[model samples]
Target: MVFFGDSMLETLGRVVVFLLVVLVVLLASLLSLFFVMLRTKRILFPNFVLFIVSLLYEILCRLLSFFRVDPTLIDRVSVEMRNALNYTEFAATDPRERILLLPQCIRSIDCPARLDSLEGICCVECRGCAIGELSARSREIGIRMYISPGGTFTERILTRSKPKAVVGVSCYPNLYEGLLKAKLMGVPAQGVPLSAAGCVKTTVDCEEVMNKCKIRS
Candidate 1:
């Protein structure tokens, strides 16, 4: 009995060491891919890199912080990678089957839009901010637009609307979460990162958004 117990302990120790080695290898590979992407603005082995990023997201961020690097760098790269991976499917969806979600922060400070339980913010196109122009363009292409009040509202919109594809504009962190959510829901989504991020009076690149919205061609 004593000999069997000792063997069991040794086996467990070996398994733990193997897992630690694997973790270190994955972390090193992910960091290498991240630096390459940053320098080249190109993704290599995108799906593999994304898997590592998702698997070690928290730990990787903490590691970056320890090295005095901006942790959100990985988040930004992951978002871009997701966009590239989903672009073909997203572009194939019909305009009518797509929806555009804009963050509430991008709205003008004096915006007159009112929030509803069902539809979120109702944009009246008062021309107060880029949203009005975007709303107009979305209408021209037969795509529905929503100004999300928060993450919960965004989920509700997706659940209720059930669009085939989505175009979302937000900061990098929110964009990363939103993309992952869409993927889990079996929806293809394209994200446009906000040019200036803030709680209120934020700014987005309206032209870049329109370009993404019409990426079908």
Candidate 2:
């Protein structure tokens, strides 16, 4: 019994050490990949490599478990991966008080597809897009989130809200407008360009927004 207990302790120690090493390696690899992507502008390649690495790592972990090899290392890797993925969702600071959300264009009162701000408008929550979710989250965090239809209304909202920073989601034109506003107001701001993939509503990941708002600690 004494010998068995000792062996089990040794095994546990080895598993812990192995898991630590794996976690460190995984983090380093991800960081290196991020830097390479930035330096080489090889966006698609890095994304592909990350996917492959993640898949292979999971498979290896499963295989190890099938052979009764301690899965602690794999489990650790999974947790780390999840955390990294979720990191984008985490706001590094409680700057909720300083953040704002704005919309690029307002919807037409008659047609959902047609955007019209010729008369100056605002998002009406009629399209059921990310604006609603972002508003809710901002409310929860005490941040000011608004959906202004035009630059004029956007400035109005910003002035009333008196935010120290802003987060805008829109197309290139609106993004540029928001940046200009930020500069003029001396407020820090960030923008998320809408992609052609049409993920404006439910598909928008709050994690991505969080990533944009993340501050290095």
Candidate 3:
């Protein structure tokens, strides 16, 4: 059975080589991520780094799920990664150049808000939910805001508004999607994920959004 023994050894060698290559690639990516964090104004590279890390974390999430652990660790890592960026760079930007994107799911499912075509959500401050309250505050701060249900609609808003920075609120996956798209457009972006995620009645932290806006009295 020497032939069988030699074949097994050969298979083990290939597996070892494959694993070494994967380890080397992951180490390089980690080093690149570290350097990007050290001086993030190396703007373009940070976006690419974020994309790569996102893919890595997505794989980790799948592995975690296979073990029946919390799969949301992927989203958590992604949120932290996005938050680690320098938000203050856009602090002094004009309000017109900034947009706050609110998912329509943030509204009460039975709420009477309507789409205004150009404007995102037509709100009457019914006090049914945080939508009216946030709209009022965003107006006071002079930052444009939209409450969009997903579709070509949000993309249309992006095209028309052409924001240089965005404060978006949605579930983690949707938030991540927006970040990647904003990166492609060379827009600085951040987000607050919903406290709960679903097709209906998701909620966000209004206080956190205000903090992001750095709103004035």
Per-residue accuracy of model 2 over 1-217 as CA lDDT, tens digit each: 3566878999999999998798667655654664465466444343344354455556554655876866444333332332343333333435665665645432223424334443233345554555555656666666655655554777776776676666666654345445656656866566665543232331345666655654433
lDDT of candidate 3 over 90-131, digit per residue (tens):
565666678888988878877998778788688777878887
Give Cα-based local distance difference scores for all models.
0.91, 0.53, 0.73
Error of 3 at 179 (Å): 1.1
- Highest lDDT against the true fold, candidate: 1
Q: Candidates ranked by TM-score, best first?
A: 1, 3, 2
How do all models score by TM-score? 0.92, 0.44, 0.75
lDDT of 1 by residue, 1-217 (tens): 3655878999999999999999999999889888988999987998998888888999999999999999989879999999999988998988889999999998899999998989999999999888999999999988999999995988889999999999999999899999999999999999999999999888888889888888884
lDDT ranking of the models: 1, 3, 2
Top-TM-score structure, candidate number: 1
Look at candidate 1 and give me any clashing residue pairs.
Answer: none
Of 1 and 3, the candidate ranking higher by lDDT: 1
lDDT of 2: 0.53
Question: What is the TM-score (0 to 1) of candidate 2?
Answer: 0.44
Candidate 1 RMSD to the real structure = 2.1
- Which of 2 and 3 is ahead in TM-score? 3
Q: Is candidate 2 or candidate 3 better by lDDT?
A: 3
